[model samples]
Target: MDGQRDEGYVVVVNSEEQYSVWPQGRELPAGWRETGERGSRESCLAHIDEVWTDMRPLTLRREMADGTGR
Candidate 1:
């Protein structure tokens, strides 16, 4: 946990035209519906705000080896 932590974001879109934004490397919870136009854009934005507000920060090790090294 002492190493520098990197942050990233991703937006997932499903066949139904619905989507959810999540911290890039993590999996969305089971049964969490990620897509649909059921809610307005404002609602979706608000939901994202609410969910990310409480998410714990993630720490990751850097992958420094390049193509030559691998």
Candidate 2:
């Protein structure tokens, strides 16, 4: 794989509030949208790490909160 430092990336989030880094200037995958934060892959990952403190998906979190999840 190419060095991530050479490529640009953007922070993206889905309905589940999960965050990820997508290639800058590339079309985002279905159900994911850019968070308007763009930079080196490391920066994007840092952004996700800072914001995505909870690893669980939105639905699972909700279920847990409602006492429905395992």
Candidate 3:
């Protein structure tokens, strides 16, 4: 991210259900897309904290369920 305040921020999510904060209006990284969420980094982080209680990615969850997780 540019780290400049003018960039603002947005929340992003990937197929694995991971949540992250990214620079607003910036190009998104692979496998992650915008969630239509825009705000300060702190607010976005707080949203992630609240909604992303299960930090494990979807693959990990499937692995654990299949008894193949470490």
Candidate 4:
């Protein structure tokens, strides 16, 4: 089988005072989606901050078994 994996980090800066790092295309934990859409940008940023904090660290990597790293 041939397949390709894309990996990267997402830095969400909803506002100046708050931000979050979403690794490997992973969505923020449950409830965060709702939080990001509600109220002010600051509030959304704060929600991201709270969700990402203390979560396990992540390392993104993509290697193709077929040797094409596509």
Candidate 5:
């Protein structure tokens, strides 16, 4: 493994809604949920780019909605 690329990947999301790519067969760390998108690393990264437009934390988003996150 050169670490430059991976053949199998899965898109994962955490409780905070952040996105990341994980190796396909590895166990996801706590707080992350697999989003059901599985493919190559590039595709998984592309999926994250497509969906994760807002980089704010989930707590921040909730607070902003309630007008308190300043």
Candidate 6:
């Protein structure tokens, strides 16, 4: 399958803001919600790369923000 013209994918995010590509028109797993961006898998992954700059999970980020993660 061509990356540019595949079955299509949707960008989904969890509470941690971690992103992943899910099959378009399929039910997302629990705790994951669509970021409203849908396109080729490559595009979805690119979107994840751009938006998920901080690789830390939400809880860890909060802890770091509170100066406790260290």
Model 2 lDDT per residue over 11-34, tens place: 999999999998877788899999
Error of 1 at 19 (Å): 1.9
* Local lDDT at 27 for model 3: 93
Clashing residue pairs, candidate 4? none
Worst 10 residues of 2 by lDDT: 1-10
Q: Decide which is better by TM-score, 1 or 6.
A: 6
Against the true structure, what is each candidate's TM-score? Answer: 0.29, 0.87, 0.81, 0.27, 0.88, 0.87
Prediction 6 TM-score vs. true:
0.87
Q: Rate residue 14 of model 2 by lDDT.
A: 99
Q: Which candidate is the best by TM-score?
A: 5
RMSD of 4: 16.5
Q: For residues 1-70, write the lDDT of model 5, one tens digit per residue.
A: 6463566889999999999999887888999999999888898999899999999989999999999978
In model 2, the Cα lDDT at residue 41 comes to 84
Candidate 6, after superposition: displacement of residue 29 in Å? 0.5
Global lDDT scores for all candidate models: 0.43, 0.88, 0.88, 0.41, 0.90, 0.87
Error of 6 at 2 (Å): 11
Candidate 4, poorest ten consecutive residues by summed lDDT: 54-63
| Candidate No. with top lDDT | 5
Q: What is the alpha-carbon lDDT for the whole of candidate 5?
A: 0.90
Estimate the Cα RMSD of every predicted model relative to the unseen true structure.
16.1, 1.9, 2.3, 16.5, 1.9, 2.6
Compose the digit string of candidate 1's lDDT tens values, residues 1-70.
3231333444454433344755444576664444432344445566666555433222111122333322
Error of 4 at 27 (Å): 18
Candidate 3 versus truth, CA RMSD in Å, comes to 2.3
lDDT of 4 by residue, 1-70 (tens): 1231322334454322234544434567643322233433345455667666533322112234345454
- Assess candidate 3 and give its lDDT: 0.88
